[model samples]
Target: MKKIFLVAIAVFTLIACDKKEVDADANIHITGDVKGLSQGKLYLQKIQDSALVILDSIIVNGDSKFESHIKLDSPEMLYLFLDRGQTNSIDNSLPFFAEPGNIKIETTLKHFFADAKISGSKNHDLWKKFDSINSKFRDQNLALMEKRLKNELKPNATTTDSIEKAYKSLLTRKYRYTAHFAATNGNKEIAPYLALSEIADINTTYLDTIQKSLTPEVAKSKYGKMLNEHIKERKTLEVQK
Candidate 1:
């Protein structure tokens, strides 16, 4: 009888361990170290109904390392906001693509977003690649703006016209590139996200093409649904106009 009781206790313990492991697997486990941060609050946030909502948060008392977890239904864009008590700066928030499973973020207190090193999320990796190229377009636009300002100081109609034309051409190229990127990456959630965020004001025909190109799985994602709704709203306003 004593032997049988011991065997039953061992089996129960094994079952309990398995259950805990399964639960952990279902959650998004985030761990990171904020170098130079002695005390602060870190928040895991997502956009819901056009508002930033906090999913989880942790307060670091003296240590720079922190961990947070939250259940995710599907991969989407999320932000890690750091609030260093009594220190105000515009570089505190870091945005990352979040999916279920483990993600690690390492950054310093001084340049939170610029110094962030994110790992373990494939969606974030994809966004990083897209953003790298998109940034080039932005840089070109800024240079063109500088040229326009310099020309405006002298007020030459010919030079102004040439710069204006270049600006229009650059804008068209940027829009087309964004559309192509979204359509080519239709299988990823980032596809619809980029469309809605970057080029929603472009031709509705382009938006229509992107919406149709989304895979069945991606079409049901959070950003995918928002893209669909946004397209519909744009069409409705067009008709009213």
Candidate 2:
């Protein structure tokens, strides 16, 4: 009887341990390695209530390997800030999307932001997709501006009309693309984020449509709340006009 009781207790202990491990994994876990950083500080930052806040901070010792865990209500953008106790602002912060799971970051202390490798978040991958599309629009705008500057063109009847037409065309294409993107990704958090950031001024009705299409959980997120507020303010402005 005593032997059987001991065995049962041991099995229960193992089960409890496994449950704890699973719970830990469900919380936010970040592990980092920074070469050439024997001692310093690393901070996790996020935007909250219209202000930038540090979510967590850790001290770096010998091997420059550090770990931190935090609770997340939802997936969102985060910044890794490295404070080397120097005046240089360059290469001090890196922005990445974070979700509740294990994340890893590896980089050198010198080029902290420039060469960091981050992985292990689904939301981060989605943000990359959105970023890739947004970058193309920026490249197109850059090409347009460069052509105008290089030509040393004067703003007159002959040149200004064509330039203005080109600008309008670019805006139209961007607005249409933003609408399509939001429609397709309505269930994802990135939909409202893009609507607010990429095409906030496109049209209030379209923004309203995107907001209405968001999943209930995403619609209640920080970015979603901001998007809703923006649409409301736009409507108020139109009424005043």
Candidate 3:
């Protein structure tokens, strides 16, 4: 009876140990090359309709090699940014599934993102879903901007000033508010995407309201033209790219 009891206890201990151990999730390494650029930063952000979460970031080493590890619970949108680098490949969204172990990511770019290869997951469906959603959102944003530019409406000086001020606020706004949510929930990947998504609306609504409040002369002055021209240039850049 004693020997049988000891065997039972030993088997229970082994089971408990197995349950407690967690294998390292797949490895994730991101590689990219930028023409005529060096010493920039790369960030990975998680996306949501309501907010963005910053999952991780790293300095682009001289060799342009960067690696990170992510353990995903479910399918999520990954936002990549070259971050102030002159490289045309500044932003992209990809679907990522993190299982147990390392995955490899390699990308090559001449002007924009040219090639990307990912290995170590069989779930290609998740990637397709993410890509579709990302494209839809981008189209929606461009459409809104195009509509505003085409309207050709004019606003007074004071109102336009207020609007521009508000637009600037979008960039200056702190990330802490959105990021706090991720930290509180124990999934910190959504902060950056959440923060960036607000920039467009902040500019649009503020300009729409303030322009209606402007005086005619203020609208026609060099200052007003400068502001309008700046906005036009931004639009041009977006479309050209």
Clashing pairs in 1: none
lDDT of 3 at 202: 35
lDDT string, candidate 3, 1-241, tens digits: 9999999999999989754233366344434444443576667776544577777776664766666665555433466655765544444444453333455556643333445566654333333443455465556556545544544376456655654565445334322332333223222222222323332333433333333333454345333343345445556766898
After aligning candidate 2 to the native by TM-score, how far in Å is the CA of 84 from where it should be? 3.9
**Cand. 1 TM to true fold:** 0.84
Tens digits of per-residue lDDT, candidate 2, 66-131, equal: 887887777788889999796666789888878777999888987887778889986677777776
List CA RMSD, all candidates.
Answer: 6.7, 8.1, 19.0
Q: What TM-scores do the predictions have?
A: 0.84, 0.76, 0.36
Q: Which portions of model 2 miss their true places by more than 4 Å? A: 1-26, 87-89, 148-160
Best by lDDT: 1
The local distance difference test score of model 1 is 0.88
Preferred candidate (lDDT higher): 1 or 3: 1
lDDT of 1 by residue, 93-206 (tens): 899998878999999998888899999988899899889989998999999899989988888999888988988998899999889988988888888999987998999999
lDDT (Cα, 0-100) at 150 in candidate 3: 49
Clashes of 2: 0
